[model samples]
Target: MEVILARPRGFCAGVNRAINVVNKALEVYQPPVYVLHEIVHNTHVIRELEEKGAVFVEQLEDIPKGSIAIFSAHGVSQAVKERANELGLRTINATCPLVSKVHRRVSLLNKINYDVVVIGHKGHPEVEGTCGHASGSVHVVSSPDEVQCLQVNTPSRVGYVTQTTLSIDDTAEMLKALRRRFPEISAPSRTDICFATSNRQTAVRELSKAVDLILVVGSKNSSNSNRLREVAQKNNIPAHLIDHAGEIERGWLDKARRIGITAGASAPEHLVTELVAWLRENYKVRTVREMDGVDETICFQLPPI
Candidate 1:
């Protein structure tokens, strides 16, 4: 069987920077390093870091006073930062700079007397953080249907931003619907979708069309990873979102002679290597054609340790 692997499929620069923040902090500060959330959404990465003395906590209250605490790359609400500060946790902001850019745009819009709308999943940490930027004006709408039903404080004066990780086509469709409904609506001068997300999805869209089945390696909670599977499924191709090779179902490959594989930004390369090796050893997989596409060198500097 032929397997097509997309180049630049895993570990985007933001994810790398976030993971490195935790790693470097642990190295410099020693054990008992506490992270406010999973540095990134990959299961293996979290397990590995946890083994190395990094403690993951969902709330600032769980961290000891006077200890260092990291905000995940997912970003956090203003309230979270305030609470962490109140608790005496030496806060390290590892939020992706791209995500922070969106926040800044929306903040500017709010400051200029515009009611803001956000295109993203409700309750996502990033969305919550973004909404916190404008509690008086910001609104969250996830779908075109929701946009149709949305009620803004003012009809003609509105702006919007989106989560860093969302399906590009889906968000475009929603944005189009919103624009159609509100002709005078204004949007950010820039796009909020991160570069890594756009590139990965673009690569996978092409990869999906060439293979009978596609595998997206990522945790279920990972928004970008889930969108990869949705992209493949939207093309009428069978797709699986799995954490590792063990999660792969042999039944899906019964009729497929070729498969495409890609991983989310938070996923590491080792899972991809292991999965491909498994297919090669047991499923007669051979002749991998590497589809190298985008070039990404984006990196964020960690806050001083």
Candidate 2:
């Protein structure tokens, strides 16, 4: 058995920055640093941070007044910011710059009286945060079918932004439908899907051709992680999204000659290392190689603590 790892697979610039934000906060402040949501979606990352005294909370109200509250990399809505201020919490904005760009785009569109549309899964923290930026007509459409059912205030005056972690092909399909329905629709100058998400998916697309089965190491809730699995499945390759190696099913690997391994943006590289170790020990894997792909050099600056 052989294992092929995807290049640019784990810990993108934004995730790196976000994790550093939490770590820097821990260094500067006392224990119990409040985070609005999971700093990043990886289960292992969150567990480690929790061990270091980061408190993840769903609501701002749960945080004590005047305490330090750090926003997750997923970003937060304008209302969330206001509420945080109302509670007298010392807040640190750890939102990924790319996600913040989407917020600014939607906010500007709404200010200009354009009915905004967000291309993302409804109820996702990032999507909800992006939607919250728009006070006027805004809609969340996840599919090409949903685009047809959109009821914007003015169909002619619509603008759109997408979640940073969406599947590029899927987002393109939605964009096609949106353009057909609203001929004059406006869009950002650049694609909203972040560079890391695009690079990882492209790497997976390349991996699908070489491997019999793809194993994506990431938490189920990680959007970019899920997209990586989808990219493999779309290529007719069997794929599984697992948080770690323990979840791997022996039956799934029985017939595979070469296995592909990739981790999501938020997943730690050590998880991928452990996965390779497991395959080596149990499957008697003789070769482990990394596929040639993008060498991501981009790094986001960490927010001040």
Candidate 3:
């Protein structure tokens, strides 16, 4: 058996910055630093931060007044920011710059009287946050089919923004449908999907061709991680998404000559190493290598103290 790893697989710039924000807060401020949500979607990362005194909360009311609070990398809606101010919390904006860009774009579109449309899954924290940025008529659609059912106030003048974690091919298809339905609909100068998400998916697409089964290491709730698994499966390669090495099933290895491993943007590299170690111990793994792919150099600056 051979194991092939995907390049540019884990810890995007935004996730790195968000994790650092919590670490710095722990060092600079007192204990019980409040984080609005999971700093990133990985359970291991959250557990590690929790061990270091980070308190993760879903609502602002749960946090004590005047305490230090950091927003998640997923970003927050305008309402969340205002509520934080109303509660006298010392807030740090740890929203990923790319996600922040989408928020700003949607807000600008709403201000100019253009009916806004956000392409993302319903109830996702990022989707909710992006939608909260819009003040006027806004709609959220996850599929091209949903685009046809939209009842916009001004169909002729609509603008759209997308979640940063979505599959590029899926978003492109939805965008095409939106344009077909609303001839005057406008979109951002570039797609809203983050560079890290694109790079990871590209790497997976390349790796899928050389391996028999693909194992994606990430939490189930991770959107970008799910997309990576789907990208491989869409190419007719068998794939599985697991949180860690423990979730790996012996059945997945049956008849598989080569296994490919990839991690999501929020996943830690240590988990990948553990998976490889497990493979080496259980199977007669002859060769383990990383496939040639993009070397991501992008890094986001930490939030101001």
Candidate 4:
């Protein structure tokens, strides 16, 4: 058996910055420092931080008044920030820069009297946060079918922004639907999908061609990670999104000679290391290799805690 790793897998610049902010808060603040949501989407990362005294909460009201609170990398609605202030919590914004850009774009659209359409899965923390930025009419649409059924107050005065972690191809199709319906709809100057997401999807597409089965190392709730699995499947290749090596069933490997491994932005590299080790010990895998792909050099600086 052989294992081929995807290049540019695992932690990206934004995830790195978000994780560091949590760690830095732990060092700088009192114990039980609160975080709004999973700092990233990986369970391992969240567990590690929880061990170090980070408290993850879904609602700001759960946090004690005047305590230190941190927002997740997915960003938060303006109302969330206001509520945090009402609670007298000293909050740190750990929102990824890319996500923050989307929020800003949405706010700008709302200011210009354009009804905003957020192209992402509904109920996602990022989507909720982005929607909060728009005090006016804002709608969430995930597919072309939703786009067909969408209704905006002013058809001519409409603008759109996407989740930073969406699939490039999927977003393109959604854009086509929006353009056909609202010919004068406005768009952001640059694409909202983050660079790390685009690179990982591109790498997985290339990796799928060389392997019999593909394993995406990421949590099930991770949007970008799920996209990776879909991208491989779109190529007629079997793909599984596993949180870690233990999730890999022995039977799933029985029919495959070549396996491809890739991790999501939030997943830790140690999980990937352990996964490869598991394959070697349990499956007697040999000839481990990493495919050539993008070398991500971009890094976001940690915000002052």
Candidate 5:
């Protein structure tokens, strides 16, 4: 069996910054530093942080009064930040700068009296946080089909933003549909999907061409990771999204000569190495190569101390 790895697969700049935020908070703050959500979506990453004295909470009220609270990389609604302030929590925003950019775009649309149309899955934390930036009309649509039934005050006064972790192709189709329906609709000067999401998907697409099966290492709830699996499957290649090497099933590898391995933006590179080690131990892996892809040097600065 031959193994192909996707370059720029794990830990994008935002994820690195978010994780570093938590780690730095743990080092600077008192024990039990609280995080609004999973710092990023990987269980292993969260587990490691937990071992280092970080506590993950879903609600601001769950955190102790006057405790240090860090926002997740998915970002949070402005309301969450206000509530944390109300509770006297010392907050460090670990929101990915890219996600924050979307929030700012939504805020700008609201300021201009334009009804915002968010292209993302409803109820997703990022989508919810982004929509929260708009105090006026905001619509969330996951697909191009949803655009047909979307209601707005005026099609000409509408603007759109996207979840940072969305599939590039899916978002493009939705954008095309939106533009077709509302010729006057406006969008950010650049696409809202982050560099990491786009680069990883591109690498996976390249991997699919040379491999018989693809294994995506990421948690189920991780949006970018799930998108990687979807990108492969959409190409009619067999793919599986797993949280770790333990989830890999030998049966899935039957009749597979070449396998491609990639991880979601939030996943750790160590997981990929672990998966490769497992493959080498179990299968007659003859060659391991990394497909050439984008070289990501982007890094986000940590929140002020």
Candidate 6:
């Protein structure tokens, strides 16, 4: 089997900064640094950090008073921040700058009297947080069907935003449905979906051309990772989204002479390395090369010292 690696895979700038902030906070401050959510959604990354005394909490009240608290890369609503402040928590927000842009857009829309329609999975932490900002101004729509059946208090004044880690095709379809229903609805001039999500999907489309099977390394709950797998399958490539090497059955890949490997932005590089080593030892893996694509250099700065 030959392996084709996808460029711009694993640990996007946002995830890097969030994880680093937690570790660095642990190093700089006292033990048991608290995080609002999974720093990035990878179980391995979270477990490793948890071992270092980073506490993950869903509620601000759960965190000890006066503790050092860091928000996840997925970003949080102003309500959470305000509550944290009320509790005297030292805030170290590691929200990805791209996501921060979405929050600002929602904030601006609310001020302008535009009701926001967020296209994302319900109960997703990112969706929940973004919704918090536009509590009275926002409504959630998941699938294109939801858009068709969706009710709006003011369709003309409707604006749409999305979770950064959504399937491009699926979201486009949802947007089309929205536009059909609300002809006057406005969309973001700049995409809130972030560059990394687009680049990874583009790379996977390329991978599907030469490879018969594609492997996406990411957690089950990871939206972006799931989108990568879906994008490959949509292109008629047999694909599987596995969390690690243990999930690789080898049976599914037996017929594949060329296999493509890509990880979600929140996934780690080491997981890819571990899978490659396993393939090299067991399968007759002979060739390996990275499929070229867009160059990514986006970075989010650490919170003020």
Give model 1's TM-score versus the native structure: 0.97
lDDT by residue (tens digit), candidate 5, 1-305: 99999987999999999999988888887579999988899999999999999999988999999899999999998888899999999999999999999999999899889999999999888998888788889999998889999989987899999999999999889989999999999879998999899999999999999999999999999999999999999998999999999998889999999999999998999999999999999989999999898899888888895
- Residue 161, model 3: lDDT of 94
Off by over 4 Å in 2: none
In order, candidate lDDTs are 0.89, 0.94, 0.94, 0.93, 0.92, 0.88
> Residue 78's C-alpha lDDT in candidate 6?
80
RMSD of candidate 6 to the true fold?
A: 1.3
* Candidate 4: Cα lDDT at 56: 93
Lowest lDDT 10-mer window, candidate 3? Answer: 296-305
Cα lDDT of model 4 by residue, 1-305, tens digit? 99999998999999999999999988988588999989999999999999999999988999999888999999999999998998899999999999999999888888989999999999999999999999788999999999999888899999999999999999999999999999999988899999999999999999989999999999999999999999999988999999998888888899999999999989999999999999988887869999999999998988879
- Model 4 weakest 10-residue run by lDDT: 278-287
262, model 6: CA deviation in Å? 0.1
lDDT of 2 by residue, 85-184 (tens): 9999999999999999999999999998999989999999999999989978899998899888888888888999999999999999999999999999
Candidate 3: lDDT over CA atoms?
0.94
TM-score of each: 0.97, 0.99, 0.99, 0.98, 0.99, 0.96
What is the per-residue lDDT of model 1 for residues 117-219, given as tens digits with 9 covering 90 to 100? 8999998888988887774688899999998888877888888899999999999998999899888988877789988898999998888778999999999
Q: How many clashes show up per model?
A: 0, 0, 0, 0, 0, 0
Residue 61 in candidate 4 has what lDDT?
A: 90
* Model 6 CA deviation exceeding 4 Å by range: none
Between prediction 3 and prediction 5, the one with superior lDDT is: 3
Can you write out model 6's per-residue Cα lDDT over 1-305, one digit (the tens) per residue?
Answer: 78999987998888988888998899999688999889898988999999999999988899989889899888888888898999999999888888888888788888888889999999998888788877457888998787887776777888989999898888888888998999998889977787899899989998899899999999998989999999999999999999998998868987889999999999999999999998998888888888888778877788863
